[model samples]
Target: MVRQIASRLFYAIVILLGVILVVSSLVKLVPGDPVDVLAAGNPAMTVADMEVLRERMGLNRSVPEQFVAYLGQAVQGDLGTSIRQGVPVMTLILERLPATVELALWAVVLASVIAIPLGVLTALKRGTWVDYVGTFVAVLGVSMPGFLLAVLMILWFSVELRWLPASGYRGSALAAFGQAIIERDPAVFWNAFRYFILPAISLAFVMIAVNARLIRSAMLEVLEQDYITFAAAKGVPGFVIVIRHALRNALLPVVTIVGLQLGALLSGTVVIETVFAWPGIGRLAVDAIHVRDYPVIQAVVLVSALLFIVINLVVDGLYRVIDPRVRDD
Candidate 1:
């Protein structure tokens, strides 16, 4: 396990470095001068002055020099300051990462909680109302676009029902729980949760549907296998055999889906964040792009790529740990 983990870590680092190098080059492909965008409407500078300013900021450097400098600064954990905002790129990402993390974790948890049991039950009752319902859900999950879901959720939950807060993170849950406890309010955490539900559900509903179908299929196949039959013939408790033996075998494919969905959530939350007014890293990246904040754009891309690589490594290592059969593969 140690050897496997070490190997995965080494590969993840290499992938992250390569991604960073690519992003450093790719940010330059954006069709505008970041310095001009930053200095927009500042009548103090002429075109020649702007050129001088760009040279001083190293924007005029050869791509090789720029990449080398970027790598050197990145090695020291300096993701560069945002040219547009005059803030450290890392600081901006860190401030917003918690919200993104909260959203991603909640989305996965909700998807798993809803999907796993439905899938097992659907498999258990293969040709019935329950199975039909699961199949319908899977189709909907596959078909419904997340942004549409996000909009529908906002209208139904936020505008119509008044049951939950509309959008964005709010600190008000801390108020109702008493002033002293408010400082560390579990209530505020609950506020965070309440705001999370709509976005998380919108993000997760399709995933739940897909997972349910996969789990149902996998569990059905596993249940029909010899070991499950042998356990049943041996007079083992039915639930015990199903839960302990059948479920473990059923989870192999579901685990792979979990990993992929999670990585996608981390990468693809931009549209959701934009729609819902969630201040996640994705939203920040979008704003940076609109303004041609070159440094921030590069930092965002590299950070997200690094995150994806790390998640893949973790998922792969977890798979190896869970299934010895996978090692042979």
Candidate 2:
């Protein structure tokens, strides 16, 4: 198991190196001078001045030299300062990381809570109205784009019902909880949860639908397997048979979906945050792109790529836990 984990970690390192190479090159690959975009409305800036600025920013270096310099700086945790924001790239990402983390965490939690059991029940009750309803929900969820859902949710829940905040993440849950403790006002925690719900749901609904379908199919297949049949023949309790035997086998594919979707959920925050005015890393990336903030863009891309790789590694570990045979395999 340790060897397998070590092998995966080595591969993850190699993949991250590739990501850094690609992410670092993204600015050069894009057409047009990012400096020109940055200098827009500065009528006094001359070509000479622009050249000087470019040289200072290391755009004048050969690609290989620039890459080496970037790797060297990155090793020391300096991802470069955002020309647009005039702040260190890592600092900006860290400032907003908690909000993004909060949103993504809630989204995934909501999705798994709703999808897993619904899927298992749907599969168990296949060929009935319950299954049909579940299928309809999955289709509806998958069909609707997240932005559209965000808009509709804001309209219905925020405007019409006035039940929840339409958008914007305040302080994180911990902060809210701390405030609750400090002030003896439990409403702080609820307020935090309330502020989180719409955006999280908007982001998660599609994933929930997708995960449900995957779980349903996996469960159906597992339920039809020889082990399941033997367990049934042994007169195991139906609930025990489903929970202990069937559910465990069915989880591998679902785990894969969850792992992959975590990255998707993170990226999807860009749209959700834009719609809801939530301050997160994704929204920061959008602003960076608009201003041609190369350092910020590169940092965001690399961070996201790292997140995807890390989630997959965790998923690989989960595979071993879910089925010990996977370790040997």
Candidate 3:
């Protein structure tokens, strides 16, 4: 198992490097000149001054030399300063990373908590209203756009019901000192949650549907196996038979999906984040794209790619522990 993990980690690093190289090359291939952008924005710059800026920024370097320099800087964790903000790319990412992490965690938790159990129930009660309705809901989630759902949620909950704040994360009652609700301010975390509700739901609702449907299908299929009948004949309790025997086996594929979605959730929430006013990496990446912040864009994409590689490693390692069969192989 250790050896397998090591091998997988090695491969993951290789893939990550390859992806970063390709993405960095593509960023430089963009038509616009950053030197001109800088000069235009700096009204004091003459044409000669712009030429000096271009050379200083290494826009004058040969492509191969530039690529080599980028790799060297990236290896040293110097991801370069943002073109628009003028802050270090890594610094900008770190500022927003915590919030994005928290948001994604909440979203994933919301998705899985909502998905897994209903899925099991749907499978167990197949051909009934529960199953049909659940299936229909899953279809609906997959069909609708995430941002639209977020807007609808805001309209219903915030505008109409006045139940929660419309946007932004709440730091703390201690931090703000104005919104405290007593000995314990449930308001802060709770409002943060409420603020996240629409964004999280919109971001994860499709995921929830997918997971539920997958779980339901897996359960129903597992239930039809002869081993399930044999277990029943042996007087194994139904719940144990389902949870211990079937669910564990079915979880392999589910775990794979979960791992795959983690990276996607980080970078794929752009539209939803914008509509819901949720601050996350997706929103940052979109901004970087519009402003042509090459460093920020490159770093964000690299982060997403690295996250995907890490998730695959984690899931593969987990499979060994979760299933003895994989460990043996």
Point to the candidate with the largest lDDT: 2
TM-score of each: 0.91, 0.94, 0.91
Per-residue lDDT over 200-284 for candidate 3, one digit per residue giving the tens place of the 0 to 100 score: 7777888899999999988888888999999999999999998998888877788889888776887677787778666667788
Pick the winner on TM-score between candidates 1 and 2: 2
For candidate 1, what is the TM-score? 0.91
lDDT of 1 by residue, 74-149 (tens): 9899988987779899999889877887688888998999999999999999999989998999998889999998
- Lowest summed lDDT across 10 adjacent residues in model 1 is found at 171-180
Of the candidates shown, which would achieve the greatest TM-score relative to the real structure?
2
TM-score of 2: 0.94
- Using lDDT as the yardstick, the better of models 1 and 3 is 1
Poorly placed runs, candidate 3 (over 4 Å): 172-183
lDDT of 1: 0.82
